[model samples]
Target chain A: MRQDRSSVRTERDEQFHDFVAGRRAALVRTARLLTAGDTHLAEDLVQAALTKLYVSWPAFRRADNPDGYVRRVLVNVLTDERRRVWRRRERPMAQLPEQPGPARDPATGPADDALRQALRDLPPRMRAAVVFRYFHELGVEETADALGCSVGTVKSQTARALDKLRTALRPPGGAAPHGAASHSVVLRQGVSS
Target chain B: MMDLHDRLDQFAGSPAHPDSTQIDADVARGRAALHRRRVTGAVAASATGVAALVAAVAIAAGGIGTGGVGADAGTGTGDRTTANGSVGASADGAGDGRVRLVAYTGAQPKGFTIDTVPDGWFIQTDDNYSLLLAPDRAKNPGPNADPSRDPVYDPQSFVGKIGIMLQSKDAHGVPEGTTVTVGGKDGVLVKSRPAMTPDGSQPPADGDTGWELYVRQPTGIQLIVQFWEGLGLTQDQMIDIGAGVHVHKDAAQGVG
Candidate 1:
């Protein structure tokens, strides 16, 4: 019996290792979006999620959609961290400057600035919904599953978040920013259904 | 002129070249967590009532003794030497290869107080919720510097600095880390590993070896004192600093 248990543990460990090796980069990518370009926080979130995933490997491996399970865990960790930070009531840093436009990131150009700021401005759960639906290209149902929210909530949050992004990306003097025409059309398609 | 979705995809960016260090750290931390869970489970299954509580405390003590840099067993006299032969017990000043701690003379912050701070570090920001300490360097703006001009040096950035605050309300039941004693009160210490990529965007990599020590206050709130990895403080020194924390009654309870 002990041998059986040991062998089971070994098998699970090997599977967990493979899962981590394969999914870590993508996980970090998603986390980077969730954290709105805070690389360290993104990495920390991913590591923490991965740690929890490792502990629940047997159940995770048995799931019908393991990738969805992984996404859920990652989102959970991110929101949990945010909740802790909020609960502590001591913000490490002030909110990004209350400028009209997005904060500058050296890695991105002026065009990408607005998108980054728009995402940062969203509440954590709302931002997660948008990232899952748009960046990860997950459907609303999948996004809702990953977010542990109702599909209706996902739609509402994504729609509201996209509206904010649209406004933020709009150019001064009421001119359409780059790709505004096409994006407006896409947003119509994205939110209507 | 990219579509918004395309723009977001670009903004999210591609993952960097894989780092084995991260994967390895994940597995190691996972295993440690599993081990802890199993130990706790076994303890719960084997005891009941006060016996279980006593066992839990023993387990915590044993875990800390084995998991951390071992209990200092020092006199708490402010003079014992650490493994590196630096004064481990002294919170008053730094020694060779040791972080210096000096009596904090700044106006008392709203939330917390400490008897000693690392040498040359100053209270950069004093809010009801947190106290920030930054090194006294030219580049770092003095306390209450304008954020408009020096966003990087803004105390709220919390980058490359020490932070002291009360633990979040939700963290009350969570076991923070290895147990230790600070000024005769129980404390917990958690040390974070260095980031795989030391990019400046990260909080601690600029010079922090992340260490967070939580000392329980008489009011039952845990006062958390965290150091940037860059400070290079030994565990003994961390305890010494934690020993000096006083959570003011006015310190607001963290919201959750």
Candidate 2:
């Protein structure tokens, strides 16, 4: 509904173009992470989000921080575009789950493999929460604001998301409790905090 | 103190730049939508909802595979506690009760209702596929952006992508225990360890295998049942829910 974007009187379409052109890669990457590294699906998600932003660009441009508006759109598209499927025709001749470790080839790369699995293990929302919070380092309030929720909600999502990440990344065994919603677990790269 | 999460989050990436064609294409889509209407006073948008559904499920059901997945029907989707006791619920509202499927309004054929998804949770569906999105906020957020509009880019660039495999299956994996028919195809249900990966590469040998239920629902379409991690339910639990996969006998008539 570009018409909807036309409806908004404030933000110039040129300004919006600059805005989109600038953030294109980031939006795709974020969508990629949310879609568990599915680049094909990730592109679709980004396209969907851009369309939404185009519809609301005028109104959103008037509001504070249009980038945040678009960011919300990107995240929402990934979260909302849930029914994406990739089909495989092969019967169950023999199947293997992709290793949590790096692949033999360099293109797939070790970091990419590990990171992909870790991200894939997260629930969509939790994944969004993690990407938005930790990757973007958005504050609870900012994350909530971008996501159109309260700060408290952001806190709990972050906490729960951290727990899920821990579960996925941790060796298959028992781990400690995630404590309470009031606190958040700050996970570092090689060493977990 | 360093906790499990801290180290996990720190699982850093070896950054390499990805091409920007998709961004260009996204921009083109938005601009085309805008110019189409602006130039022609009409907009013929690509509602991939239904098309994507057909492709997603059909291709996904027949997705690339080199092995059979071991269905650990005996154990869990993740940590056992995360199932019942874990997965902290929203303290507000009526609490973490079961979700109710509200109305049907996707691009799919008419007259179908699955289980009740929670409120606040948005529905993302096509003719053959569907997903209940729990917003990063527990409040169940709405769709991110309007499909018909152009997106404003983030300066940071499209750095990553996320993939989700929503699977449903009986104890035996697929076609054997439970069946779900969507669209018009009687898809042969198959469940095996999905070879999912992020970098466009295959997964390792030891990753947790998902229970999949494959069927042909739409015209020339198949269905694949998968979820985020594992669905903590047992074989019995999955069967219980899978029993409700609504199949319209008449609609599924021509499906092979």
Candidate 3:
């Protein structure tokens, strides 16, 4: 029993170990972003998903797409958490996420700051859909899968989130902030309201 | 689709991974649990009772099952006892009705509706932080000996309250099963069994010592365990300790 036990255990755990070694970083990063820069909560979410994966290892091992399975588990845990009342009761941490220092594209300019602030101010659910779609750049279906909702919901939420951002960041006079660049987007997206 | 795709892709540099060491450690814990359960030595009756409670728990947990407690007696208690070191022996002698045990403590200093609790009660690891509980009832909400009525919901049905109920129970660890009468009805017992090494309980010719646990949730449905070969504590002692624990319901858990 001793001789065979080592072999048997290795056979059982090999796939899981490989998956973690290869994909752990990506999963952690996604969890980090989803948690809005809370590294600690992100860690908890990743562990929770991975722990569940271990419990259901038999099924997960044979699944066609294990990464997707893991991602689905992560998002499911998050949304389930959102709906639970006790989750609402805990005190939020006092730490602040290191804000992305200014948009990388100089041409995008100071307006990007206002737009980003507007986006961050949205409700968590809407923000998640928007961030997954725009910032994370996931497909509608993928975003739906991650958020455990339908594509149509994602589309509408992203659109509404965008419209709100545009309105929030819009210069009061309906003019673009300096660079006269706002004129360029106004014509492109018909933002002439 | 195209516009949204553009935005999401901008940050697709790559997702970061958690440390490999962390994942490995968690996997190790899970595998260890499987082995620890394997080497346990509970007696046949207690083992049988544990199996029944597990089946009931699985049902309460919303998993596939044969649907009732009758199947527990039919299972092979010997093999199962060795598989799960503890015996679950908390079944009720009471008639059909629902009973719940909720414990609160001095944790969460900012929250209200909190009460003080005794020390040393072991909360199930996952549930330690949750203050709300939804105790799922086993298939046999009452004693198998008396089969007159059935309950409507099990603890599994109390899904939304997992975090809160779990926390309250976590604050106080249960060492023995203590029964009490609440609302003038016979209350069930709540208790815990301490950590036992793999070699502690070995059945003599298909017998070994094992700890006991009893549970009935979402009201009625009780399970009692007897560890291997009578070497461990009796079902009666388990109940005595279980009956001593106290449980109170919250508006969230109590709500329909």
Candidate 4:
């Protein structure tokens, strides 16, 4: 009995370690976006979610969809954290005016910064829906399931979020010129709404 | 000219590897949590069995004659007792029916107090800024309960929860909710159905409800009381929980 228990523990630990090693980066990136680029907060969210996933590892491993289970846990943690008044009260230093500007990668520019701000401005649930739909490329039903909401909710929230993003990112003179390269990218991405 | 989708894609660009040190620490925490859960489950199981046996013996002895097992069970704290001995049903008139206020002071801001919550619910103060009240059915399952069959850890299992936090500096832009008086102080109350999404749009969930009260205290402390409707708790009961909240200056300062 002791040997069986020891081997089971070792097997569970190995599975958990492998899962975290493989998925931590992706989960952290998603969390960073959810937290609007607060690396520390993003890491905290990811860690908490992983811990929760570990706690329920037995059930999750037996289930047919462990990835979905983990994603749902991440979404739930993000939503709960966002709802906290103290968390809302605490602003990242990047958001402070007196602080130096956020360090931008060479590939990123003023437009990307504006887009990031716009995304951060979105409501928490809408942001999750948008992230799942656009970034993770989950289907509408899948995003709804991840958010524990209905597909209609996902569609409406995504539409409204897209509208807000367009308004926020629009150039000085109306919409981008027809057939502009970026416009083509948007069209190809199928989020032109 | 860039579309929102492209921007999001760029924003979510390649996932960078996380720090190995952090991962190790997190894994350690996970292992610790697993150990704690196992220990807690064992203790809770034994306690439940003992309580059941005691209740059965008392019933056979005709010691607890009336009110069924629930009333008799209420007199015993079972596993729900806190260190402060604030877990029992209230004898005070403030309680409604069997629902008594379970005084809670854990995980709250300094000077924060939730004088009472309904009985028969499990209260958790492990979170930094909230007090979660989950039904007995929702807490970690005991020996007799199979978690595989009865998953209680989901958020929906919670009947009601109260969160108290210090108001942020940039809270002026918050939309004016319904004006009301709580604990002799003026506050704004906002009630929404299907709970407002993070972006402030009402979702399509018709049954879920959320109530929030933002009270500006005389001491420049902004207290927010938020309750999610669950476990058959009415709006009035949620408001009552908010009204009973008391905060003092000394206790309100330096909260995380």
> Best-fitting candidate, measured by lDDT?
1
Give the residue spans of candidate 2 off by over 4 A.
A1-17, A83-109, A112-115, A171-193, B1-24, B35-256
Task: Provide interface RMSD per model, one decimal.
Answer: 7.7, 11.9, 12.2, 10.3
Worst 10 residues of 4 chain B by lDDT: B196-205
Model 3 regions more than 4 Å off: A1-8, A83-125, A164-193, B1-20, B29-256
RMSD in Å for all candidates: 12.6, 22.3, 15.9, 13.1
Residue-wise lDDT of candidate 3 within A91-177, one digit each (tens)? 122233455422442312222344445644665567677656655566788778867788888788877776665566566677655
Q: What order do you get sorting by lDDT, best first?
A: 1, 4, 2, 3
**Cα lDDT for residue B223, candidate 2:** 40
Candidate order by decreasing TM-score: 4, 1, 2, 3
Error of 3 at A72 (Å): 1.3
Which candidate has the highest TM-score of all? Answer: 4
For model 2 the local lDDT of residue B53 reads: 73
TM-score of chain B of each: 0.54, 0.30, 0.21, 0.45
- On TM-score, who's better, 2 or 3? 2
Against the native complex, each candidate's DockQ, computed on alpha carbons, is 0.19, 0.05, 0.15, 0.22
